[model samples]
Target: MSDQDSSSSSSSQTEEELDGEMDEETNGEVEKEESHRDSPAQSLSTFSSSLRAVIRIKQKYQVMKQRRQEMALALSGAGTFPGAPTRTSPKIFTFDGVTPSAFPMLSSSNPQKKKRRRRKRVLFPNRGTCRSPPKQERSRAKYCLYLLFAIVFVQVYNAIENLDDHVLRYDLEGLEKTLRREVFGQQGAVEGLLVHLKDYLSTYVHNKPLVVSLHGPSGVGKSHLGRLLAGHFRSVVGETLVLQYYVLHHCPQEADALQCAGDLSAIISEMVERAEEEEKIPLFIFDEAEHMQDEILDALWTLVASKQSNEYLNAIYLFLSNMGHAHITKHMLHNSSSTSMASGRHSALVKELTPVLRSSLEKLHQLWSEANILPLGLLEKGHVMECFLDEMTREGFYPDHSNIERLAGEIEYYPAVGGHEYSQTGCKQVVAKVNLL
Candidate 1:
């Protein structure tokens, strides 16, 4: 029985040893599992950090690309094309928004860098912002307004340059009243004279000069009417018509009629020659032609005949004389029946005159045939008033009808010879005097 008890005790001790070994193995396995789980957490944290760095690098690269494109566009003189890349880099910032930290790697340690940076800041203060206005549109609007003002100033200067000082201005009403009495009242008498003058001018007279003699008493305004006709002719034609003034006063010193004819012929030839070369037709006005030497009349007759071929020399000789027509015609008949007889009497009388004078009178009859004669009569009361008013107005003075009546009364009844003494101011003064009376 003691041997059986010893075997049982040994088996119990073996069972206790096996239980301790199993517990040690279990504890080691639990510790290894805890270590494996902790290692995974650390590795995950490292991976996350690396991924964030990569993303930041990519974002920085994109911003740099945009900045480069914007700089190229601003500095280049070339205009941008369609579909060009327009993106600009965003400006990088430090912790404080006031300071920029972009491209800090490019900064230098040299003192010159600070100066360059300062200049850059001055040139482009908002360089970081880089937002711009459209440039081309603003410049075009400024140019258009400048052009408009220049055109208006030129037109005003041209208008002031064309005003004339010599032009005479008159009311149309006053002129019509004068025409009614002088031109219309004479019935066909004035019309007949104008018709005859027109016919003589148009007709080709062979060596025969047209002598239109206007004979009337003094203060009749005959010379004034002649000037008016000459003015009308000039207006119709583009150029002025030349009218030569000749005054024939009775020369008490002249020996005979022929000598006077020679002198007159030389004067007519010189005037006619000048008119032909200048392409002008002249009117010879012989004022007081009746008082001329008989020789002078014959010399004029010769000149009219010699100028037949010269178209420009085909002239109108207006003889304003106080001599009656009957006396003139009777004198012509007594000379001779011969065609040269009219000029011969003057030639015979002036044979002893200068050689130049003798040669001039040789063709006196021909010149006489080319002349036309027209008689001027006294102006009617209305016509006289109209002329006086016209003269006053043209001198920058205005006159009423009462002024005209007074001027007409002062001059019309007075025995003043010719209208030369009828001064425009004198007419006005006379009206003022009458007003006082």
Candidate 2:
């Protein structure tokens, strides 16, 4: 009984050991299967990243190729040689894991050696040279250039077509009479000045500056003559003749003689720069000379003198002052001790100038000595009457000589209360008398 019981125990122990070994083998097989599945998924991820990189490289190559072609076209238009050709397409290659035997295999050779005999050579072709772009890209570039030039040309032509002539409005009849009396009358000192002016203008045309001063009393008409001369020059010279007319009233409220220097300097610099660039001379006309600041006058002197030194600024400089010849002469003497004093006294005479301009009086004297002074006088009785008659004619009113003479007599006798006073009643009476005639 003891032997049978011991045999049963040993059999049971052997069965338990066999079951443990089978479990270990099954677990090992499961681990091997998991590792094999993970390998394929990792390979797929690597292939996807490589494909993306290749696509990016292809896109960059295409962009570079397009830019190269555009540059070539631009260089051709600029009359320059085109650059070297560039690759447009990506390259492709192929390889096989096979090789050819050096010697023919005999029927008696080893089977393994015979099986490994055949091999294939790898090939890599340049795909960039194989393909050509369509001709439409070249045509499109040419069309763009043509459109650009056409638009630019049209804009330039339109700008030139929109310019108009510039003219200022004033009393034309009064201006004409003022000029005739000052330039042609018997007692006219302006007659000698006229001859000198003609010579000066002739010299001015040959690139010489003409500095002229017109001085007279209030009613003697220096401003009217100045405007007339400016108009005459503009009418004959078609080139850009810029006119800068300065009056005492035109000065800004904040400006004093010294403070106005910057403004005046800027104006002169701008004018000179314009003249230099455009090849045009500028005419500077200063009226109401009595009101000009001393500093302003100094600036003008500097500009004129500096321009005189330069070959370019042979432009006309006109000065119209109500200050008489005595005033002008005294100012000149105080400013300069040169022969300008003799010339100022002999060439021009008016009444008297203000003493405020004494500081730059020498510059004024030098200017007068070098320049031609034209003195304007009052109108003659007949010329005055003729001017009135002409004004009446323009208004569509005709007057006989007898009636005109009666009206002239009234104007002459009551001149202080009537004609020259610029009254509405005076103008109406003159108009009525002309209508009756």
Candidate 3:
């Protein structure tokens, strides 16, 4: 019985060992078959995937390249900016690692970049945006914009200041009234002055500057007219607008041309500076244009052409001269026939003399005339008496009717003998004798 139990146990143990070996062999066979089946498909799939990844990388590179080219063209026009950094090759990068400013097309205020930029800011505390490429462009553009604005403002100001004559309006009638009230004679001359000024007010005339030459014999109130002009304008505009220069006083016979020019330039520069404030033209009066040196005249010609001098001026230039008028001939006998003849003759003489200045101006090519010849004809006994009486009244010596007759008799009166003749003793002498009377 013991031998039988032992045999059974040995047989069972051998059978268990055999069963384990068979199970192991079957499992190995199954695994080998499965591996064999998967090998080719897996290898093929891996190759295809790698190819696709390479194609995608190339496509991304080409797209990035094109974008870079566009940005280069935009920022530098045709090429790269001088002294600025430029990239030569395309670089591969993940979205997380890409620089925010690497793409110029991106908006600066992108929300996604804010956290990354903030992190970078902490890491690079000394890196201010002033050295950034985009900001530099913006800074230059701002400067250009300011320069353009300034140029435009200057052009607009100049255009408005050089307005045309038709656009100008003033109390011309008021000026006429003022002249008529204060002055004794030369009604035609006064009217002519107004007409010229009207032309100057518009672009059609000498709008930048109008020079007026008052040609007449001495003591015909040429200087007086100038004073009246100064007074009239000073009252309305101000004292600064009018500049008076006596040709005899400022420019002596011995003074050189350069000296005269320097003196005039100083005056003109100062006048223009002051006139700029009011935006109105300034006035210049040359008391004796005839006595002005030839060199001074030439210098003036050059000066007038400069906008720096004439642009701010009133366009009114008055020159007083001893010569240039045709005196009235014949004595006033208080006879109607003689008076009529004398009046007719005087009218003819003035008519002829009016063109004389115009002709001279054309011949000399001188704007120096601002020319209009209005002869202050010889004052008749009546006119001189009127002037003398006016003077006496102003001096607190109101002469009665008989006193006036006696004063007239005491005054020597010389009349123009002919159209070509002039008064040897104009009212100039008559003025001195008034105090004696």
Candidate 4:
């Protein structure tokens, strides 16, 4: 009985020990499972912190790179490529209510779309082929610019021309009126002189001096016309540029011709030099040119010839001569008709008389060949009466028309065509007759 009781007790004790060991194993397994779950929470916290730190570092790196690129662009005049990296503030990431493992899934949600946008921003050109301006439009703009430049150039050119014309003013109209009013009865001579003067004075350049020869009988106003021209030129260009020389007064027949030529040449040289310096045209009138010796004419020819110096070429020379008076008087008495006295007939008269007058003067000097022969025609009886009236009025006396007619009728007249008579002495005695009045 003792042995049976002992055996039963041992079994119970052994079973109790085995049960305690099993409970210990179950508690250890439960503690391990709880520890494993708790470890996941701690690992998640650590992973989230590390992930935020990594993101912050990457954002810092991106910001630094953007700043570097911006600095480079600024240093290079800000003309960098459009897709070049630019500066931007870093975006702060919040992991609230989100697991660290879900970060990759969230970032990858629209990977294709992100990649397309990045490529478009980084590689695409700012201006596309379709957006570029057309070649035709560009050419039109260039053409418009050229046209505007051309218009400005043309306006400048015209302004310069107008200014030049104003500066070189020659009052031809005033000269014409003065000649027509003051110089009477020699209509052809006045017209020819004016035409030549107008053409020569219109421009500032000349190849040679203009030489005009006035040929007629004595007492036919040759000296009077020379005085008028000298006065006109003096008024226009001042006194220094006008030289009125008389053969008898300046170089007498008894004086040495060589010395007289030298004096005349010096005077002409001084006048021309002064005129050129002042940009002016000069006038020279030689009265009684027929009395000038060969030496004097030769000196004049040197000055007035085509081969003269540039400064000497810009002058007007008037030669008053009685060399062709005989021929001129004969031709006028033969052709003195009312028809021949008209302005239209003046050209025919010039054509007929130029050869004869030029031939007569050329016998004296070859210089006359180079001259423009202007013949002073014989005055009519009516012109003589008009002259008497003019002289009477000029000497401060009241002109009596009947007395003028009587004085003009007393002057000898040659027979003319159409019963019109011309005075033989063309107002030469009118001044003496007026002084007697």
Candidate 5:
């Protein structure tokens, strides 16, 4: 029984130890539950802090990604530069917040390419554009056109100057002064002749030769005027260009008409050919044309009407005739009395007598119709006295007015109105009378 009781005591001790250990375990579990219930605010605060930190990190990541995308866009086209290394995708970037320019290897090549491209743009601005052709060539062509126009203008100016020179070489002004000074008592005849000369000689080109016909009575200065022209032309153009042919002297009344016509044509042709070779205009005087036969006139008409050659075109022909002397004298003595009335009478005579004379001359031959008719009017006693004075002076004798008046009075006069006597034989005997003096 003592051994049993000792065992029970030990058992009880063990049971108490066991109860203490259980009690300790239950208290630790209670403490742990109380601590957990009391720290709820701290745990909630830590969870909120962690969530805010995560949100901040996510926003920073998003911002960095956006900036990287923008940087990539900005640097995207860099690889497209000519002579640079090409990339499959231009948007090359790293998400480490490091730009492409940050690396020396990439930036060094990029600046050189950029400088090269800028240099290319500055140097070859229009290298591959629409205006790439040669501008200098077009400018040169424009300059050539300007030069061509200038050349043409200069040529035309020279042509005009040459024409002026041609007209000025004729010395027509000298001829006009000489006619006004020397010719007398026939103011209208002188003026008409001067006008025709000026008109014809102003230009060297003409379709036909000029033909002038002088008609009047005997001793009315027709032959005198012809002699004056022959002398004047001989002095002016040198004697080689003047041909004076008198019907009584060249082809006399007794000569064969056909032979005379042939000889006259040959002589005229030779003279014209010689004058043309010398580049000179010739003067042909055919005096006493009324005495010319039909065959001689026909030959002259053929020669004068020739337009076959330029040599035949440049000439002057004077035909002195007495065909209309009766009409010319009647018109002059009836109309004109003094020198003052001479000019008025001359215009009327030309108006009235030109048609009458032309018709009369056309009846003889059509060649005379084309002739420019100049009528010589009758001279008054005063004109006859002046003629006497001129002849006396030319013969180296003293020209006393009384002696000239006596010599003029000796000549017969036509019985006219107002007792204004007109000389019947005007200056025809003045030279012979002066010789006697």
Candidate 6:
């Protein structure tokens, strides 16, 4: 009975020892799981710190990039001309929000020369490696960049255009010297036109825009004079500002006539606005003004009456037509004095006869109907026979009469005494007729 008791006690003791070992094994397993769980948290913390560092770097990079762009704009403006790039003083970077502990500070122990060389190599004073911006920050930064680029481009273009304008301003010294040499026997008329034109273009003449109506028989230098004026003005003002539209060519079909008129209105509006901005005079020439549709004329009447935008104040309008030619000739025929007829100086006669022609143009309501005229008059007379003959010869037309007498005789002016037809057609058929003659 005592040995049975001892065996039972020994078994109980062994059972307790086994349970303690099992408990230790379970505790070890729990500790291992806790350590594994803690590792994820530590790794997350590390990742967060790395993200903050990258954000800081990006911020610094953005600041540096903006500063560099500003510097580049300034440098480009200064170096707009070729052959030399502008040199500006180097700018130093400011470390405002950055912490020295976060990023190691780089120190330069090199000489001034070495430092200058390094500075030249660097795009920015504070260049550093950094990751791309975050998505939200990236979008904001792109918008700012685009805005900055647009503003810079506009400013640069304005500056360049201002410089270009200064270069483009020309001197019309010799051009102003010999103005009326193109046409013959119309020196008086041409001189009169030029005087008024120059006066109208005069800077002090701020009264209103000039409106010149050129009237004559067909083949007169009316259209040719218009071309000459275009060339002269193109030399003075740019070719862009001198707009010549022919009613016969542009306003052909009756269907789209109104549309063409509206298009012209829009164009005139834009050109007037442009002229006002540039402080320059714009010229609009309507060749064959008598032939345009009434609707188109109404569109132009706005410019004529100065009834459109205030910007129209800086523009000039020229109307070339044969509307008042018959009235001019009748007045001349009735009033040609015996002294004038005997002197036979055509220039003097045309010059003296201008007053009656002006009166006749006033009666013709078709021209400058309600508009205020500024030194306005009709520029008339065909090319002089002498000038016509020279031009014909220059054009490789050798008439049978080498003396230029036959060509001169053929160039007949309007209101020829009884039954002669000479230059009444102006410069129109002289060449073709030269072959026929």
Q: Say which candidate scores most in TM-score.
A: 4
In the range 1-437, model 5's lDDT, one tens digit per residue, is 44434444544454466557556655655565556557756677555655665565566556655654564444435425567553333234656668776688877897899889998889757566756576654456888999999999999999878666654665666666766665557777877887787677656678998899988877878888888888877876668788899887877765588898898877778877887787777889999988888989888888777564877788899999889888877766666555545345565556567887888788889789668998877777877877877787788989888887788889998986455677788778987887786
For model 2 the TM-score comes to 0.41
Error of 6 at 256 (Å): 3.1
Which run of 10 residues does model 5 get worst, by summed lDDT?
85-94
Residue-level lDDT tens digits of model 2 in 1-437: 34334434443444355445444544554455456545756676565655665565566556654554464344334442257332222223323222445334643476555454532112444557659764654567788899999999998766544221111122233334556654322134445435544454332233456677766544344665566667755554433455645655557453566767667677666765665564445566788776777677667767666544343355667788755545543343353333532343423322223223333344544454545555543333454456457657767766567656667566432232112222112222444556565
Question: Residue by residue across 1-437, what tens digits does model 3's lDDT show?
Answer: 34434444544454466556555654655555556545776676565655665565566556654554454344333333467554332235457435867775675656659867887778755556658555433468889999999999999877766653234434566778888876655666677777776666644223356767777766667887888888767775588878888877886765465688778877776876676666666677888777777666766666664564445445566777765443222222222244434465544445655665566545654654444555555554565566677778888887676776666566555543433223344457656777775
Task: Estimate, for each residue in 242-351, the C-alpha lDDT of model 1 and write its tens digit.
Answer: 45454444344456556656665655666666656654445666666645665676566555545445743456677665544333233323433444332333333222
RMSD of each: 29.5, 25.8, 23.6, 21.5, 25.9, 27.9
Model 4 per-residue lDDT tens digits across residues 1-437: 34434444544454466556556755655565556556746676565655665565566556654554454334434333467644322334655336745778766667767888888778874566558575753457888999999999999999778655733465667777877777667778888988898778866678988999998886677887888788777887999999988888887765588999999999999999999999888999998887888899999988877587888998899999888788888887676654755433766777789998877778878899789999887777777877888899899888888877888888998776656677788878988988887
Worst 10 residues of 6 by lDDT: 373-382
Q: TM-scores for all candidates?
A: 0.37, 0.41, 0.52, 0.63, 0.62, 0.51
Question: What's model 1's lDDT at 265?
Answer: 61
From the highest lDDT down, the ranking of the candidates is 4, 5, 3, 6, 2, 1
Alpha-carbon deviation at 143 in model 2, angstroms? 65
Off by over 4 Å in 5: 1-170, 337-345, 418-420
Q: TM-score for model 6?
A: 0.51
When sorted by TM-score, best at the front, the candidate numbers are 4, 5, 3, 6, 2, 1
Candidate 5 TM-score over all chains jointly: 0.62
Reference-based lDDT, each prediction: 0.47, 0.50, 0.61, 0.77, 0.74, 0.61
Weakest 10 consecutive residues of candidate 3 by summed lDDT:
327-336
Give the number of the best model, judged by lDDT. 4
C-alpha lDDT of residue 434 in model 1: 40
Lowest lDDT block of 10, candidate 4: 72-81
